[model samples]
Target: MDEEQITAAAYNDRSSYAKNRNKKRKSAGNRFLQNAKGFGRKHSFGRGAELEQEEYNYFLEILEALNGMTGDDTEERSTMANNVYAQIRDKEIKACSNQLSSRVLDNLLGFTDEETLQHVMTVFGENFRVVCCDKFASHVLQKTLFIAVLRCIGEMQVDEDKDASECRKKRKSDVGREMDYNLVMDFSPGHRRVCGKFVKKVAKFLLNNLEEFVWDSFGNYVIRQCVSNLAGITELKIGKGNSAEIRKLIVPDKWFKLINEFCSRLLVWPQFPEFPYNEFTSVLLQNILTSLDQTQDKFQMLQIGEKLLNDSFLLKDPEQDQSDERQKLPKVFHRDSSIRLLEVLVSVADPNFFKDQLYKRLFQGNVLLLSQTRATNFSVQKFLDCVSDKHILEHFFSELEVGLEEILQLGHTGVVASLAKACSRLACQQGKFVKLLLEALHCSDATGVKLLTPVLNLMPPEKQSSVQIHLHGSLILQAILDFNKPIKLVTAILETKNDQLAKVFTDPKGSFIVNAFIASKFVGEKSREKLIRHMEGCYMDLALSSHGSRVLELLYESAGSSQKEAIVRELSERVAQLNSKPWGVIINRKLRVEAYRQNPSQWKNSSKAIGGQRAEKIFDDIVDTGSQSKKRK
Candidate 1:
């Protein structure tokens, strides 16, 4: 036989044999849950299936209409949505699974009215277990969940009005909680009824395959969107809702119905210890923890903690004994994947519980050790950030400050950065921290503002053969600037010499010191003015460099009318020189220097103003998420 004939015969034989093997496996109890269906499901269009030419062409026409959609042209949008829905009416599964068509479907979802979206989601629910796990279909499903959440949030805010006493109390609680925590203001009787119905619809889809869903990478992001949006969404409560105000509200506690079910699966998880440690499942667990209420789900939080931290390396201190067993205990936090899970637990954990049960036992004595290692140093930093008690912080400071110099020397300035942030967060003695930081960098004895230079430089003065900047040093300086009693630090900054000031403004990282100082509410107005005066001789120099020009712009925004005039006056003086510099034209126009050249008074009178606080999920770094383009392909 010819070679081509022989090859074709062998390929056909192997394909038939493989099919027989899959059939045998299916009869033996399919372990991979292949083709698992939701109840009575019939329209099972497979994942990434090829589309028929006729359907593909019509969907493209639908896509063209969707892309053309703009404004609140409700009639046209409604017509387009109905036509598209008509195309997919009995074939939702097929429409959702086509890789090219799913992109169009996801956009059409954004344009659909609430009633249409609810119907589409109901169809999604019918085969939620199957379609949510599809590579091509999951994106469309995630987009739908995002819209549902916004609806719930808007609906909850639809109350007729809040009384004055309730308003005052609500404002006080909302203001502080808004800054730090992801709290839902009040899940009062009014809104809980509305949120419960929506949560039920969404959670029902996951319960059938909750375990598989939480661990299914794309599936997990759906849960993350649901929880994170619900947690921080009280932000929307403060907004004037869109033209049609959604007095609809969200119930934060009800989010746990799904979380609790997911956690139950964690207990009997067929995989045991390996399940929580698996990278995908680890992220799912972290997202659930972030949305937990301290009082409502405290037990659940601790239980999940116990499950994750169950191993000796996590729960026990390595130093308690001189055995090899003790040596392995600290290794738990050193792995990149493991450290984040531990940090998430620490952040959500009750302070007293964390300190007594977790912190002192394992991380306390290892402070210096954790700070020096590449991975565990982050754990040290996380601990410092969550710590609030003065005495506990003092105790931590006692250990960390002793090795603070070594930590910096080893290029572990992040540990020091966290310490500075701790000082800002706790309203503790940051002046002392500034002192310790300066002393650690060996500038303690430097004569004056010379100390500030080393910090901005992240190098001791004596060792400076050349000037190089480090970003951490800039962050540390900013944190110090945020301190309540920053006078001591402010004095050092104000004392920065003309030459030193020039160096500060020109360097990309160092120039940020001016913005932080000027923006600081603690610093008096006079300190800011003095800062502008320090830039007087350097305005031409400042406006010429990219970073320096940014400093000039910020100074202008925060500066008084007088400071604005001075900036314009100074820049115009050296306009000719600045016009020739590398970054001049862009900077000049950005700062509106043309106004100074043409008609300065009009610009002076009209001072124009132009304008992720969310903590990352712990397991994000470890996951190998594919790009959207690759997923479609």
Candidate 2:
């Protein structure tokens, strides 16, 4: 507990960090972070390396405890957190390196006073570049920025009121003011000023380090929070003189302009680049562009995509007379990272750009080839996702269907899955797709129809029977079942033998197919009864397994009064046996096993009292909740 007893944090090596930085593409932002000269670093070593390891691991345990501490912003929770905060005050620098310690620190900021926050800001603010480079420390800094964004908005508003009417500043003792603990930032103005000062320092720091933050893996995240979260402080408004209001910017204009410049730089790629693309940069760029798309800035994403895809480096000499070759798009977009970036670009590009330039240049005649290559298969799926026009989607289906079996043979299931979803959405070529799907899975038209088990399991014929179900196969079936109720698939499923059918019921992924079937709008009452009758003997086995219990519940809920009575009666006789398994207790209580065991006649009367209306939440199947919602609505 004594200050003398406190030891230094173990020193971490920046050799790998420096090596990773050298391998990444040269960008202005990364250069600045590389040149920051230990901006947020304080180094001192404790005891021996073994002792330091013990202390570091011990600190992680303490962090876990702090984050797991619960409260509803009550004084008790705050008091408990402060006690922990005091103990860690000496180990503050060391604790920041703990992966999730920031969450506990974040909670502390919300419940504790502004002085505690000021201490945090002052300690960490001095070394933005150094701290932001470590992944875990970056997480803590990001949380601090997020909270500061929310709290400062209120603080800036109060500050603006005083600046606008110089003599009208609200006093701290204003009796009518109420504290809203629900909002962490609606504090006394003095607290607001403290928060405002920290925000100001962050804005200044961000402006100075914009280039270094863009391409550095960990540093890029800090830049994103500043741009997305704290940039809005400029939007605060205040009443000027009489009847008019004007903007009261919290962060200066130069900071925002620099932020814009930083964003614009993220999208640029030269025709012939100096270095290979970095995955971290690709991920960050994707996030920024996606956020732009979501915020209705599609025009920005579209223009950026069009320019990146269309524009290339110019020939040095006009007399070279090779404009076409010089202007040709680079192979950068074909790399795994770039293709993923292109996926987002394709999704948000204008229909004119997507259908015309992309279809002709990237997708038109390359459908099967794209589907065949392992990495490019995703681009094939993206085409299916974005080509919303029936005519375009139809063209895709026609070509993809020709090689459908080949596509399946090669294990490129995502392309197949996306194609199925597209057809279902467009309501074009539904029957043909289903028929083709059979041949594709069977690898022969002659044997396709009878290989339903292989199709359900998404395994080739030799590998089919009881293999765990593929997630994509489940999605495809749910998509098809949503397609106006295909009777061929429905009848085929119902006619399958009980023992074979139970295999699908027991798989975690395959179990959802039962829910989708029962939950689909297409299957009428008689069809439901037929399915239930087929599954009767398998019910007890299904009830005993964990995943199987969910399917058993779905079947019981969808069954008619007669079928419900039968299921309850069967389960009643086996209630003690059913209770032996973990999920058995849940399934038995749900099936009303005890009530049925007490009196069958009484249970029959209760079923009739509901007047044939479907029970609430009973049809809410675990397979795909959206499946039924899509049908009923």
Candidate 3:
């Protein structure tokens, strides 16, 4: 045979061996099933008969194999034996097989006595090494051996009645009875060492598989043991690092719940030690406050805040009897918790914390407590002091702005007026007041007036009469100097009938000011004609007042030639329109006589212009007819 053919045959032979090995394993499993059926019929046991028998036989075979090995080969053979034993004694398979065996035993033998079970467990544990040496041993077998050993120990203690006695003693101690000092003193270091090892192994296992363990059937017991171990670990100097490692394994959400529960348990459990409980509770409270503050969910924050406040109140209250020597006390309130709690409460209530009752309780009452408790609480006081700081003024203004917008949205004119008045009071600076007034103006005319009324009311008593005048006068001047359409402002000013303003216009100090304002309208070329028309209107309105003659004299003196011509033409037209009236006749008669006395040329010229004699005779006849008509009547 050539090399290639030889290799091919070898490959075929290996394949055939693998196939046979699988077939044999399957046949063995089938045989166990048959044994289970037979045992069910003969012993009236259904569950674990076959599995347990198979495991026991597997263990016996490994022992036989180890017994046959030579001394020189013993080391290697022993190693193999141990390996097989571990597989046979595995925890997972043992749990399943034990569950099944317990069910079967309960059905057939009516449950094994604790002594009998202890013996069985001991025998299995003692021979597990031989079972583990077998190549047939699997992961399930290893787990089973481990669990079986633990069960043996547990069962032995029960059979000896020591477990119940110890449990009762522990319970009594937990309930406040003094432990027997001599009995505790008699505890062996060996037992303590063994317990330490056991606890370490359990903690390590749980920490490594924490997620899976937490989801398993023994999750509750595992968590309880883990917490107990963690507490124990914290006490030992060597265990501190391990404890930290274990803590690191916990997720934040789970950690929060665990810590909260731990604190609660400490508060309620009679057996909880004071030092550790106090330490852990402080850490837990700090963690909760920090987490609640960091959580951006406002609703969730509010809920947590309420819980914290209630908890804090309970801690601080003197009536709870929580001040006893044995009680684990809460930490002195650091400013952080106090401030955080205050922020949350105020934010949740949506109260104006700067000016509200809630603010007083937190910033004044509780902060005072914190300061008294903590020497380094100055920073905290500063933080709390910010509660009523001037920064709130800005916030108030912003809210005021928002309130105004709301009023506009609701079309609540009355509310708008009230808010405007409120804003004027709050505005301290001239610029701010002016800006607010402008904003009110843009909102509504009535709102502007309402807002202005307060400002007008607030002017210095001596300056009260001048406030409206100054504002109106300034506005009017602005309108004229800017050459804007002044009609709106003029109409508003006139309609208000501000006596202060009227006085200003009449006073010597104010008259020229008013004239200067009117004169600015003529500064624009386009405004000249409009200015002239406006001036004429003003003069006509003044003419009706007692100041008419004074106003005319001032205008005449102030006018340029072109303005003079315009005013003269306006006055002449006024005289011509009024000539038919009694006042006009008297004025004309007076004017004619004055014209003659002042300038005979103008009088002779006026007399000759209209054929004077006929005009005079006509005037005389009209007068005589009037006299005759009066007599006839």
The Cα error of candidate 1 at residue 45, in Å, is 15
Better of 1 and 3 by TM-score: 1
Which of 2 and 3 is ahead in TM-score? 2
Clash count for each candidate, listed in order shown? 11, 4, 24
- What tens digits encode model 3's per-residue C-alpha lDDT throughout 124-148? 3444333232222222233232222
True-structure RMSD for candidate 3: 41.1
C-alpha lDDT of candidate 2 relative to the true structure: 0.62
Top lDDT model = 1
Residue-wise C-alpha lDDT for candidate 1, range 1-633, written one tens digit per residue: 653354355456556766686456334223212222221033433237766666766665665554444333445755676668767877877788876578667655644554566677778777777677788688788766655554445434434423322343333222222211112233334333333465567666666656667767778777665655555332223322332212223445656566676667666765645544468766666676776642247888877767666542354443455365324555456355567767887888987768886687677777777787877888888888888788788878888877887888888888888888888888786778888888877887664467777787677788777766778888888888889978766787777776677777789888888878987888888888888777777777777777887887888777766777787777766655555554655566677776776787777655533211111333443243545446778
Alpha-carbon RMSD of each model: 17.7, 14.7, 41.1
Count: clashes, candidate 3: 24
Residue 164 in candidate 1, Cα distance off native in Å? 22
450: Cα error in model 2, Å: 3.4
lDDT agreement with native, every candidate? 0.65, 0.62, 0.37
Model 2 over residues 1-633: C-alpha lDDT tens digits? 221121111001234444455445223323433232132122222211212444444434544444343323246545755665665675665566653344345445544556665677777787777678776667667656655555555544455453443332232211111112313234666666666677667756865775667568778777666665544421211222233222233443443454445456544535213112457666565655555554445566665666656552111323344355421323543466777777877787778878877777667666777788787789889888777788888887777878987887788999988988888888878888888887767633433235556666667676565556688888788777767756767777777788777877888877887877877786677877898988887788888878898988888877877888887877778766676665776776677677778889987877676544444445545436788777889
Model 2 lowest lDDT segment of ten: 3-12
